[model samples]
Structures are given as C-alpha cells and as structure tokens.
Target: MTTTTSDGVATTRPAGQQPDPAHGPGTATRPRGRRAALRPGSHLFLVLTAAYFMLPVWWLVVAATKSNTALFDGAHGSMWFDDDVSFVDNLVQLSTRSDGIFWRWMGNSLFYAVTSGVGATVLAVLAGYGFAVYRFRGRNLAFSILLGAVMVPPTALVIPTFVMLANAGLTDTRWAVVLPSLLNPLGVYLMRVYIQDSIPPELLEAARVDGAGELRIFARVVLPLLRPAVVTVLLLTMVAAWNNYFLPLAMLNDPDLLPITVGLGQWQRLSSVGSGGEQVWNLVVTGALVSVVPLVVAFLCLQRYWRGGLTMGGVK
Candidate 1:
C-alpha cells in the first residue's frame, strides 16, 4: 500500500501491514537522544565513586607490602610498594607478636559475628513474620514501640547495657558482646517490610487450606520465598557485629576476649604513646588488611542474593 501526506511525501508499506516501529515518529530518535545526554554524566559519577572507594584498599595493599622503615621513611610513596617488600616479614611478626594474640582476636571476631548474625536473623524472621501474618490486640502499639526503639541509637543504650550486664555477672564475657548484638532492630524492621511486600497473604491461606500448619507453612513455603531477604538480613547483622567497636570495648576487659577492632585499637594507642613505645604500624596495617579480607570475600559471595533481594522488593 502507498500513501501521500499533505507535504506530498510518498510512504509505502506491505499490503495489510502496519508502519515499521523503527521508522515511527520520534520513537528511536527521542530515546537515543536521552541516552546520549545521560550516559556521560552517569559514567563519570560511577567512575569517581569506584575510585573513591578503591583508593583506600589500594593504599592498604601497598602499605602491607612495605616494611616499618619503608613506611615512615619516604623511600617510596605511601601509595606504592617499596623494592624491599616485607609482606612475609610482616605476617611472621604478626603471628609471633604478643604470643599470637592477633589470631585469637580474629577468632573472637568471627565467633561474635556469626553467632550474633544467625541469632538476630532468626529473631527478626520470626518477629517479622508474626507482624506481617497475624493480627492481635495492641499489635500497632507494639510495632510502634519497636519503631521507636529502632530510632534510639545503639550507643546511647551501651551504658545501661553495661550496667545490666555487670549486675548479671556477664560483663567482660563473650555473652556480653553476643547478647547485645542479637537485638538488631533494623534487621527486624527490614524483615517485616520485606515479608509484607514479598509474601502474598492468599498464598498462606491456600497453604492453610491444604492442611499445612503454621510452622510447616513457614518452613516449606515462606522460607523458600524469603531466601533473598533472609540473606540480606544475615549479611547486614553479620557486618554490624563484625564492625561493632564501642559495645565490645566497654564490656570486655580481658585482652584474650577482645575482637580485632579493640585489639588493633590497643596497638594503635601503644604506637602513639611515646618514643619508648614499640612502633608496630606496619603490623597494624597488615592486620587491618587481613581483617578486611573476610568481609570482602563475604560480600563477593553474597552480593547476588543482596541484589536479588533488592530487585524483588523493588518490584513488589
């Protein structure tokens, strides 16, 4: 078929066919123009953000390869490795120093992070599910209180937590750290929101119609659907427990019980004190590098779940 417009431009199409979408008015050209306008700025922003974050990690890597003298002496710049690289020497010193207490601190951090992460996730899942699924008297009030609790800073509660732990004879013990870490209000909030958004109530009602008990429905249906959110909450709580400093610092007095954060802080203080104090800045740098590896690996491994969860929640 052929047609002529008022401007006398001839157009042709196959018999009984529609106009080609690619040649449609403003369809391809408008999108291409918008993309062309946005791409440069977006690319620049992403590149700058990546450089900002990776710069510190790069410096840590370079510093870890240098010796104590090379670090302070300007033999090489802080951002580059020296010719006389002493990474092995630094690791050896790290292992031998203070009767290998660094390993103990690493182990303590792992324990606290894992224990608290799992504990907080379980509590959050149960609480969130209940909030999303069941309704009872004072439900709104209870949740309101929970939201208010979330607003209260964790640091502000540390003093009262310490007092209560001291009274319970748990201060300076691992429980003092792990117990306090398990109360993750943010995790609970996240789980509740995720549940409400992701899980359909009709699905649960269908499962109930099939004679599945509440526990069975949760285990068989809800959990499978909640995998992404669960992983997100787990990773968040784990990271929080891993990075927690003030709570452990106040609760623990024993060096043997200290996590990497406080242990490294002690070394930092010792290095800064006086001329007589030992300068283990190289060791400190190396330890910090080692401390970061687990978190990096964890993020790399779990990023798929994190991204999937966010995408799912956003879609819902």
Candidate 2:
C-alpha cells in the first residue's frame, strides 16, 4: 500500500508490513560522526605511553651511535644520532672488554634465570597441586600466609637474606643468588589458583584407580594438562629472576659472580669514576643496550607459551 501526504512525498508499505527505524537493509551501518572518532584522551594517552617507554630505548640506541664527546656537547637531541654509528664498534669492544667478561655475566644471568625458572615452576606445581588436591592441617591458613607473603616486597627480604647467606658461608657464590630465587611465593599462589580451577579432582581419582602412583600420576597425567600453567609460572618467575637486581646486588660481591643486571650496574658506576674521574657514557649506553638483548630473546622465543598460558589459566 502507498500513501501520499499533503506535501506530496510518497511512502510505501506492503500489507502486514512494518518499517524498521534502524536502517535500510542494503546499507552498512555507519558511526554517528564525531562520537565514533578516537577520543582525545585515549589517543593522547596511547601516544604518551608509547613515548614514555620507547624514549629511553631510543636514546640507548642513538647514544650508542655517537662518541662520548657528542653526548653533552649539545651536538644533537638525546634521541638523535651523530654522523657515525659506532654501535657495532661499541658492541665489539663490549664483547672483548675485560677478557670478554660480558659473556660471563651473560652466562651467569642465564644460569640464574633458567635455574630459578625451573625450580620455581616445579615447586609451584607441587605446592599448587597439593593445595588443590589434599586436605592437610592448616592448608588454607598456610596458603593465606603464603599469599600474604607475596605482598611483602621481595626487596625488603634482601638484606635479611644476605645476612643469612653470610652466616651460611654462601655469600659471593652462585648459590647466593640462585638458591634464594628458587622459590617464588607469587608463582606458587598463581599455580594453586590455576590448578584449583583447571584440574578436576575426579581426574586424579580416576588416574589413581587406574594404578598410577603419585609421581607417575603427576608426570604422566597432570604435567601435560598443567603445561600452560607451568609455562605461566615459569615465564613470570623467569622474568622476575632475569630482571632481579637488588637481591643479587646485596648477596654477591665478586665481579666474577655478578649477573648481567649487577654487571651493567657496575659498568654504570664505573662510567662515573674512571681513572680520569669522568664517566664513560659510551660504555654505559652500549652495555645497557646489550644487556637487554637476552631478555628480549627469551621473551621472543617463549612468547607462544606466554600467550597459551594466559588463555588456559582462565579455564574453569
């Protein structure tokens, strides 16, 4: 049916039909103009956040290109490069400096990180599985205490840990750093929560009925299922251990015992008080750049684990 108004514009409707106000069927929906545009605050926030993080990294890269003389000569902006990029040269020097001690620090960092990540993951898995499956005395209370301990800054424990190590004669040794980092309260808590939500008790009971011992059940059944959570605890604890500074700083004294974090810090301090009493800015910047590479590599290599772990950790 068709109707013509007094102004002579015609409207049409078939019998038993109604017009929908939203849109014509053939047209794609469009936004209501400015409201759909990026909000100024969000855009500004993203830009600021990007700059805040990337600025220092940019400066590190650019500064590696310039000689130390150009740093404070007002030659260019902090993030801008001078005519020559001595970055490769600096990298070579960094490798050979002090009998290639940089590689030793790098190896030490790896040893500490891998050792800690593995230890933390295994401990977390056991503690978490125990918390989820067992009914023991003071279980909840113990868990609550453990979770509470996570809130206490790890840094606050450094001095006490150092003192303990000193008495135990572990000071200035690899054990001083690695032993302390082995157990992470946060990782344990996370594993507990993950296990409680992800693994059903019935599965373990069934596994037991099928003639599996505790360790066998854990290895053959639970480990595969818990891989994602294990990865999460491993990655987080690994990053924590890799980026750790204060504990190692407080625990170990010998330069040979230093991890990259402490070693780079040593270089930074040396930058300020060379034989000539002036900073070696080039070494500082180059060392900073090189030190971050392993961290980047670790993340890049295991990024898939991180992504999958997060996805699975949310399972109920």
Residue 240 in model 2: shift from native, Å?
Answer: 0.9
Pick out the ten consecutive residues of candidate 1 with the lowest summed lDDT: 12-21
Cα lDDT tens digits, model 1, 122-149, are: 9999998998889989889988898888
Q: What is the lDDT of residue 45 in candidate 1?
A: 95
Tens digit of per-residue lDDT, candidate 2, span 1-316: 2346458975432211122223432122435585578699998999999999888888887888767777766356776887666778787877888898888998889889899889988988899888887899999899889878878988888898888989999999999888889868877776776666567789999999999998899888887877766776788878888889998888888888798889988777766754454576777778788778767777677665564444433232
User: Lowest-scoring 10 consecutive residues by lDDT in candidate 2?
Assistant: 12-21
For all predicted structures, in order, the TM-scores are 0.83, 0.80
Q: Pick the lDDT winner.
A: 1
**Model 2 TM-score, all chains together:** 0.80
Candidate 2: deviation at residue 178, Å? 0.8
